[model samples]
Target chain A: MNGLKQHYAKIIVWAILLTIPYWFTYIGGYLGLANEIVIYALAAMALNFLLGFTGVLSFGHAAFFGLGAYGTALTIKFLVPSTLVGLAVGVLTATVAGMVIGALIIKRRGVYFAMATIAFGQLFFFIANRWNSVTGGDDGVGNWHRMPINLGFTTIPLFHNSLVYYYFTLLLFALAVGAMGLLLDGPFGRSLMAIRENERRARFLGINIELHVWISFVISTAICGLAGGMLALLDNFVNPRDLRFDLSGVLVVMAVMGGMRSFWGPLLGAAIFQWLREVLSSHTPNWQTYIGIVFVLVVLFFRRGILGFKLSTVKS
Target chain B: MAQLLLFDISNGLITGAFYALMALGLSMILNLSGVINFAHGGFLTLGAYFAYVLQQKIGFFGALLIAPMITALLGLLVERVLIRPLYGRDPLYSLLLTFGLAFILVDGVRIIWGPGSPPYQVPEWLTSPLSSTYFFLTGYRVFMVVLVVTAVAALFYVLNYTKLGLRIRAGTKDLETLSTLGVNTRILRNLNFGLGIYLAGLAGALAAGFLGLSPALGTALLMPSFVAIIIGGLGSLLGTLLGGLLIGVAVGLTTVFYPAASEAVIYVMLGLVLVLRPRGLLGEEGRLH
Candidate 1:
């Protein structure tokens, strides 16, 4: 009986997530709040796709996330009013950038790779921050919002109904998450794991380690782009802050704090982190220090993360 | 045009000295302990604040001498308490811990000193302009350059001649062997970390005069230092020193040609270095992998 219940844990977790918006009323939380958590959770999961599974650490992934957001926002404001089209363009642009950068920096591993990503990532941020003409510079482009999703027969009124937008965002998040799951269960995923486990052994066994790392980088950022598109819609604005190293650091911390080794670990991490930030910020102005304290604790004790601990301590 | 170019070059040389000074310390830490000290900028900020406090009482010369040493003591304490245990672990923990430490230090300085820039006074002799034709070449800038040169010379002398430097170099090359040969690796690393922080503190004190005393002092200088190390190549101190000067000059030239891209150009140089020679200009081959 216990084994049967354990097998259905994933379904149970997904159901809980799907119904959170409805039950959020009981906890005095609004739809917008739940939506934000889902968006961050998805973003954290995307980061884990690279950090946890691929065994690569990227310190500046916000470049792609912010790119997707700006692409979506700019496309909607200047090019098209269709949110669907905006999202597609945003993801497409982010993927291309990721492919190019991943190809360039994938030659290095570990800390050097992280440093390279930070440098490359900061380049985009500085451009966005300085190019006031196109990017609107530091204040970020405002007076723009996500358009209603046009489904040919019936338009999804995402702007008016918060619940509708939540479901729509959740649908895309599910698809992105599903894609990652499938990829991780395949031979390519096995190759990535092999490299992470032992690069020397993997190289000797005929795997092109750099190519695999590049692919992982591209794939991870592509999903991050989708989340970024959702994020632009969530906040109705995209700024250089979205592209900053701070957000990249947050995503990595979320992945590690939640359990980098487990698939759902980052989602849990994102929820905990977002909640902690919200609660702490509301209560005290020194929330950043507290967050730093949290980071210190996680590094020192919970390196394996919450799920990692649970898996070891709990019997099925 | 020639005059403007000369002025920028002179200025660039001074800025390059700052980069080389800071990057040398960073390279020392990176070489000896494969950990990227993300809070290095925090140390720089702390050094600046300490000088700000000390200079008010003792004036520039005394504060300049003592502030960095105090910061080094703090660095020693921090390395022992926070950074020591994570030494042999995955480099990720050290990186994250320091990243977190950066937040604490930056915020702590802000809380203690307030967020705005505090008034910084350099000695009048140092601040006076050298010539009406070259008003940009102030005595302070010259002093900064000479001091940097002297410090670099001192560092090289220690590394080449001293028993500590010999042991550090040997340990960096082959730690397992160094440990087997009866050297106290722990003390070596702790002192090395202190020495590295001492340089950061010195750079911070010098920067406070030009940039003004602020909480944000260290972060602004940190990235370019990283670029210098990357451009110079890892493992070779000469590479880092050369890398800092090269980027400093590049930034100076870029300011003249495309002022908007003065900062971005360093990152671009980093990208070029990585793509062209992943090992870096003076970096030992295979250290990157």
Candidate 2:
């Protein structure tokens, strides 16, 4: 009975955490601006998989996120007008891109891996920016159709209202978090933790470290892509700026600030970041300085992140 | 054709001189502290901004004298506050920490200075071309080449002859061991980081005359600097100098032949080198952990 109560309590806490976006959307609608915080939160969650669970620190995850956004926009342009299909295509493309890049990059561990990812990401950014004919060259893609969810005979229009899109996003978020949780509880997740702790020992014990890292990279990137597609849909536009190195760097900050070890850390970090952005941008134009200061403090002092520290302390 | 090639080569050499100054500081920091220091580019940006501010208020010469000192002080503060804690941790922590600091610095500049490129004028005294019958070069560019060479030579002298340099070299080999040997490794590490950052600041100030000061220029310069360091091999000043010149020439030649390939050439070179020799051309084998 006590174990069941604990499980219910966990579910309730998650439900409350998930409901925060809905509250923000309702509040944002009344204030007359779209709620962008949710989209960022989703992106942060995707980043958490790599930074939090797996022991890889990426500075170029935004490349995948941006690729996914571009992928969805491209899919919408060429393929049939099914929002689900477009999102799927975006996720698929990002996953493949991540897998291929991961194969080459995962060979170099630690800082080299981080630098290599940044290099490849910059290469993609150049392609996206310079290849203007296809990517619309800096101006970004506009006039793309909003997400349209069709269920058999009835079509659910996703963008007619922000509330509807919020629900849709929330559903997707649930699915992603669920899938990620399942993966973390499985054997692969155990292997990832082992690799993170000691690669040589893991290898000695017969685990293929490279293959596991590559797989994590692929899945994490695909989720990031999905979040990007959703973001493009939310804003009704996509641009090369989405894939900028700064954006990738921001995801890293969010991951670190929220505490990469905790499952819900990214989500909390995203929420706090959104609130911070809104507050700071309103007061001063140079919000990045403030963010930078905070980032330095966190990295220097709060290595475990807030939630991670809290959980650890509680466990103790 | 031969004349044009010679011109390109000379221009490449001049460009390489600036890159060497920038890469040397980065290599020194990495060698001593084991952190990538993403904010190194931000220091360059800060140097340019400081030069711009000083030139407007004081005078061009005064700006040149003061900006690099200010940058070095900032580097010192960063080492003491932000980088000191990561000494015993994995390099990734410092890398991410510095990456965070880079964001803050770049954004801070953007906020204070605004997004648009700040207008800067090259002082009239330094703007003329230096001519030698057959070849003519921008006086400022030649000055840059001379200044960078002098800086590198001075750095070499200091590293080779000074007790401080010996401590830094010894610290890089093993920080704990050095500390146990009663050497003040922390102070040595801070000095190395400060010097590396100061050099970057000087490079930025000089680059402002060549490339023009802008908020986004640092981001663009960062990848090339990294490429130079990677190609030259980490933690070796001589290797970094060679790498910088090689990349500068490669880039200059590519632009001369095929302008489109110029942007991608550094990455391509990196890929080829990584595939052929993963430790980098000058990099020590098994240095990566």
lDDT per residue (tens digit) for residues A147-226 in model 2: 66778898777878666777787778778878987888889888988887778899999999889988998888999999
**Candidate 1 structure quality by residue, lDDT tens digits, A217-272:** 99989889889989999888999999887788788889889888788889888888
TM-score of 2: 0.90
Candidate 1 is graded, for docking, as acceptable
The deviation in Å at residue B265 for candidate 2 is 2.9
Candidate 1: segments with Cα more than 4 A from true spot? A1-7, A309-316
Error of 1 at A121 (Å): 2.2
Residues B1-289, candidate 2: write the lDDT tens digits. 7666767777777777777777888889888887887888889999989999999898887888799999999999989987887886767668777877887778878878888888877876677765664254667767888888888998988888999988888887778898998988888899999999889889888888888887766667777777787777665678888888898898789767976567678878877777777677788766655
TM-score of chain B of each: 0.97, 0.93
Docking class of 2: acceptable
How close is every model to the real structure, measured as TM-score? 0.96, 0.90
The candidates score, on chain A by TM-score, as follows 0.94, 0.89
